[model samples]
Structures are given as structure tokens and as C-alpha cells.
Target chain A: MFKRLFDWLRQPLGLIAVGIVLLTVFSLAAYGIFLTQQSSAQPIQFPHRTHVGFGIQCLYCHPGAARGPSAGIPSQAKCWGCHQQIAKTQTSALLAPLKQAVESGTPIQWVPVAMVPDFVQFNHRAHVAAGQNCEDCHGDMTLVTIAENPQVFNMGWCLDCHRKAAGEDEAKLLKLADCGTCHY
Target chain B: MNSKIPEIKLSEEQTGKWGMVIDQDICTGCQACVAACAMENNLSFVGEVDAGYGRSMHWIRIERFWEGEYPEVKMTPGQPMMCQQCGSAPCEPVCPAFATVHSQAEQLNLQVYNRCVGTRYCANNCPYQVRSFNWRDYVRPEPLPNQLNPDVTVRRMGVMEKCTFCIQRIHKAEDKAKSEGRELTDGEFTTACAQACPANAITFGRIDQPESLVSQLIRKHGHGVKHLEELGTLPSVTYFKGG
Candidate 1:
């Protein structure tokens, strides 16, 4: 059957059909890759600069970061606590989503820009306890509107910093370098 | 994950950091450890058909043997078996992908699921027959999926997994201890199996610390034997075969 298909593909009409199928498949795959590379769509264009300008800490919104594995996305109520007090929140175009979400008691879906692979058991508390600042991995939040990944969160990138941090401490280096420390 | 930490030779004097002392005499073979292990590790349950073919994904299993002739047969004590976390693990050297490697810091063999390409080399090499491979991504329909532990990575198909000595709990306890500005106390934490055991058959803790419960148990009962010790695997689990 495959040989017959191959023979058919040698003909002009079949060759065109084969080219079309191959082109379609390649383009579809390329498009899929392109989609993954694109940043996820968020409900609101949250201005991190505005929040940071007011000296609001990252821990205020994502309090779970200090306490546990997940640096949790703050609830809609948390957002409305400040936004409802702000006068511009009533009329600002960007704040419209927040206003609607608050009025409807629905949550604004914020896209998590920074995520490590599932296999990596990243604990924010451990990193926070180690005195790692939020900006160390998540770039300058004050410089961007929506959060953006400054660098690829890969093993090499992580190890580079871990190695540098573990400098002279033998136990610390051993613990930090151990795969079970994070991978398990 | 191989670390830069110097590999310690498993001499007769060198006790591992984490160790278990399982009293087989008290073990009921009730399979609570097996159930707890499955629940704690997010292990997929292969149905009866697959399980019958020896494809069940139990991280810890209960083993038993019959003593004497059939007419006067008596069932021996239930023995719970799991990854021995050998200091000189037979599984480690056989893994081409380095997925099943010894954690130098933890002094336990780690099976990195993401690193495993399902070659089953490490599983084949394991002396204890503890390694369970993911033949397929077993389904847990509906609400069953919601019970999955968030701390553990829910592995998909084509990955080999085994008992991790409940490393998630270890990390959680360690993190808690660290935040509290103190060292981990004995009985502060334990593996799911130890916690779930009704008869208190399993005791797990720092064997390196002589004062720990596991070490004390070992010292109290000096007759405990490690299975397949002659192979020089330096298995961390000590079994006390009850009379």
C-alpha cells in the first residue's frame, strides 16, 4: 500500500498533493511552535510599574511565595481592595476588566509568565529563606506592564546561580547540587 | 542527579543518612503501606489485567511465604519491600540515562522521572525488584484525579518510578525546620508508610544520628539483616525477621 502511494506520488498530480500535504504539516507544526513561544493572553493589562511605583511589594500580591511552593496569584478581592479605593479605577480603560470582574464577583485571569517544568519541585519558601529577591529570577517588575520572563528558566540557568551561591559552603553546595533537593 | 559531593564508600561503619528499620514480625501484610505509598506518590493504578501480568505500579509491596508442608502450613510474617536506596546501588550504574542515580546529599537512590526514558535498564539491574515502570499513562477517571498530591510530579507514560523515601515529606519537614531556625528532631517527620503502618512495623529516620529512633531500634535489635547483602549493594533498609 505504501509502495503504491509512493508510485502515485511520482506522478505530477500526486506530487502536487504530496507537496501540499507536506507544506500543510510543516506550517501547522511551525504555527504550533510559534503559538507556544507567544506569551499567554491575560484578561487585564496589569501595570506592574504603577503598583511598584506605589512601593507595593511582590509578596503583598503573591504572599504564597514566602510561605510555600507556589507564589499564588492573588484573589480578585485582593486586587479590588486597592483598585476600588483608586479614583481612576472607575474610568481608566485598562482598569475596566478589573472593575467588571469586581462588580460581577468574577476573577480576572492573570497569566503566569514564569513557570518551571513540572518535574522540578521548586519551593518559593526555600529560595525566599535563602534571601533570593523576587527580581533575581523574575526581572525588574517596575520596568514592564505585564510580567515577562527575562531569561529561559532552564537547568543550566538555574545551576549557574546555584553554583555561584554555593561558593565555599560544603554542606550548602552538596544540598544545592543534589537532584533530590529539587527534582523529587 | 549526580552531585559534586564526594561519594562516600559504604563501609561497615558508614551508616546512611536516611534509613529504615522494618520489623517483619509485627507487619500485618494489610497493605496499608502499599496504599499509602500509592496515594502519597501519585502512583497510577493499573487494573487487574495489567497487574496480573506484573505491571502494577505499587512503590511498596507486601511479600509473604508459606512455612512447612501444605497440611501443616503456616503463613510467615508479612514483609514490606521497597527501594533499598542502596549506598552502592546496582540500579545506578546500569541506567544509561542517569535517571536512577544516588543522591549524595540525601544518601538515597533517586529516580528522576523526567530523566527516565523508559529503557528499564535500572529496573532490570535492581536487586530488590522495587522499580516500577510506567507501561502506559494509567487513567484515574473523574474525582480520583483531584486527589493527586500537588507536591509530587504526576508522571506520564514511559517513565520508571519507585519509592523515593517520601522525599516530598522530607523536604517539607526540612523546610519547616529551616524556617524555624532549628535542626530536624527525631519523630518530627516520617515517610507515608511509617505513618500509615497500624502495627508500627516500619521505623524511618536518620541512621547517621545515633540518637535517632531508627538507629536506636537498630542498636536495640542487633539481629536485623539487610536482604541480598552478599551482593555488596549496601542496602539501607534493615529487616528484622520476626520469629
Candidate 2:
């Protein structure tokens, strides 16, 4: 059977058919990955590693994480507080935008990397209060040069964590699975 | 017609037995609630043409019915009609996808827009005609979208949406309460309509709490009546009849 199948595959038509199948599979996998790991370009190339390496806490820049729905982007003033002194000595191409923003009093327009759909009401404060660290959902920024959504925000992915957290209690599991919990 | 409104026992252990009491006497028919609801929920404006075709999406609508004709023409007091958040919603069971389901904790009829396949079954089954179908992808059109409340989802075309009693506010209040490690105080939070009402006609609170404004209003007025009680929808809203 192996000899016959190999002999058939040697033919031009069989080879083309196999090629098509392989191409389709590869394209589908690529498309799936593309959808899950969609990332955007920030106005300024904000290096997470540099900030995290300096031991600047995530909440220092994103103070709203523990206080509100959004883990707010740091204002230009907040950035200027450190950048004003750091830029004087460092003097790099990347620090130019930060200097311009601080000098002009204009805010840096940051393109969000990790974004859930509008339907999903994600409360950062609630998650932070639940003893979940920023890195739990948003992968270790200390490792990545550019921030990217490391995990998919799909329902199954969310349920996997929620279900595990809820444990064997059916009621707790149902509460986690409840559409109103996130959607409403 | 049965003419009987089924009594619902408020569950004590539940987070809240949410209820609303609308004072028809005080309602000025200003349509503030309607506008507030639309803005708060990110309801799509269907424009004049679609609205003419009865495709307008107003979660809380002022329903004005004329009783008399000519010189004696008397328009009955305008009643704000939104989702009653029925105790036994007709829309719930008909949804094949289970998109519309009752939230036992809040006593709310939740319409999960993501799960909705726009079957229109839930809309048809709703006797109050509160659920509005998005006939087309209604354009937000530039600066108008800036006003949309971030908490609520802007429902897309082919999704059935209705009044959720401002479930977003309820969630926020609940979250705030939970973080503070205390129960939500009455009047600490309310629906957009109730909050925006110039006349203060709408009272939303825990009906289970005897001291709650909604509960007090219902009791003081000798149990406000539900609209179309004969239908046995057992709506959570109690409309106080004006003399």
C-alpha cells in the first residue's frame, strides 16, 4: 500500500493536490495566529524592558489599575517627571518624542496592544483587587521589547481560567460562566 | 384576559431583587429618560427614513395614547415603556441561543448581544414590544460616537437589544461595593433613566428592602400596578396610576 501510494504521489496531479492541501493547512494556521496575536504600533517605541528593568512599578505609570475600570495610560506630565532628568543625560533618538511631548505639553497617542472586544466589560480594578498581577494577563513586560497580547481574549480562554479558579463548586462555576458576569 | 399579576417572592440571599416604581403623575413627558437611555446604552439612531419604517431604537419610549377626539381630544399621560424586566419573561424561553436569560442575582432580563443570532424570536415573543431589532448597521457618524457609554456594548446589526435596567450601573455599583467590602447602599446607584429624570418619577432600588424608596413607593401607593397584568408577564416595574 505504501509503494502504490508513493508511486501515485509521484504523478504531477497527485503532487499538485498534496501541495494545495499543505498550502491550505499552512494558511489557516497562519490566519489563526494572526487573529489571536494582533498588535498595534505605538507612537513612541516604549520599551517595557527598560522601564521594568529600572524597577518602575506598572501601577506607577498605570495608577488606575487598582482604582478604576481602565489601567490608564500615563500622562505626558507623569512621563516628564522622570524623562526630564533621564533624557538630559541619555540623549537618544527614542527620547526625542518624550522630550517633545513634555516640552509641547501634548499627550502621546498610544495605540493599545491588549484590547478585549467592546462587549466584554473588563474591570482592571476588580482584577487587581482579586490579587491578580498585571503580568498574569499581560505577559511579562520585562521580557518583551514591544507590548503584545500574549493570550487570546476569546470566551474559551477566559472560561478556562474562571473555571479553574471556581474549582468544584457548581454555583461558583455558574457565576463565572454567567453571561451577565462579563457581557452585561 | 386573566387580569391577575402573579406575585414574586423576593429572594433574600440574592444580591438584589431589583425593582422600579414609575410615578405616572410626576412624569412630565419630557422624554429625558428616552434620550438618556439611548445615550447610556449606545443605542443606534436609525435616522428619519428607518424611523418612518418603525425601526427606531429607543429603549425607553414615551407612549402617548389619545383617549378623546376633536374638541374633547384628551391625550392620556405619556407612559415611559421600556423592558419591564419581567419576573417570567416571554422573551427568555423563545431564544433558541439562550441569549435572553433571567439573571437570578439581580432579577434582570439580560440580553447577551454576542450570543444573539438575530432570530427575532425573542422580539416577537415580547408582549410589551420593548425589544428593538437593528434593521441595518446604524451609523454612529463621527463625533456622536464620542458620547457612547464605554461600559455598554454598541450592538451590531442582526442583534436583538432591549432595556437592561442599566445593568452596567448595577455591575459598577456591585463592583464598588465588593471592593469596599460592604453592601450597596440604596440610592448609591440607579439606572440612567432614573438618574436623569427631571421630575424624579422613576425610583429604582432593591424591592426586597422594605425601607428602599421603590419599596416604600409601592407600599405607600397601595401596590403600583403592572402594565398589561392580564398577560401574566409578571413585570418587575410597577407603574403608579395617577388620578
- Candidate 1 lDDT over residue span B1-243, tens digit each: 866966544346545789999999888899999999999999998999999999999889998889999799999899899998888889999889998888888999998887899999888888889998889989999999999998999998999999999999999999999889999899999999999999999999998999999989888988888888877788889999853
Chain A TM-scores, candidates in order? 0.76, 0.75
Residues A1-184 of candidate 1 have per-residue lDDT tens digits of 9999999989999989989999999999999999876656788877788899999999999999999889999988998888788898899998888889888988878878899888999999988988999999999999888888888899888888899889999898888888898897
Stretches > 4 Å off in candidate 1: A1-38, B1-14
In candidate 2, the residue pairs with backbone N, CA or C atoms under 3 Å apart (3 or more residues apart, or in different chains) clash, namely none
- Maximum-TM-score candidate: 1
Candidate 1 clashes between residue pairs 3 or more apart in a chain or in different chains: none
For all candidates, state DockQ relative to the true structure.
0.59, 0.53
Worst 10 residues of 1 chain B by lDDT: B6-15
Model 2's CAPRI class is medium
lDDT of 2 by residue, A63-103 (tens): 99999899988888898778767735258777788778777
The segments of candidate 2 whose C-alpha lies over 4 angstroms from its true place after superposition are: A1-39, A87-90, A168-174, B1-16, B68-71
TM-score of each model's chain B? 0.94, 0.91
Q: Distance from true position, residue B138, model 2, in Å?
A: 1.7
The local lDDT score (0 to 100) that residue A96 gets in candidate 1 is 89
Model 1 iRMSD vs. native: 0.9
- Fnat across every predicted model, in order: 0.72, 0.55
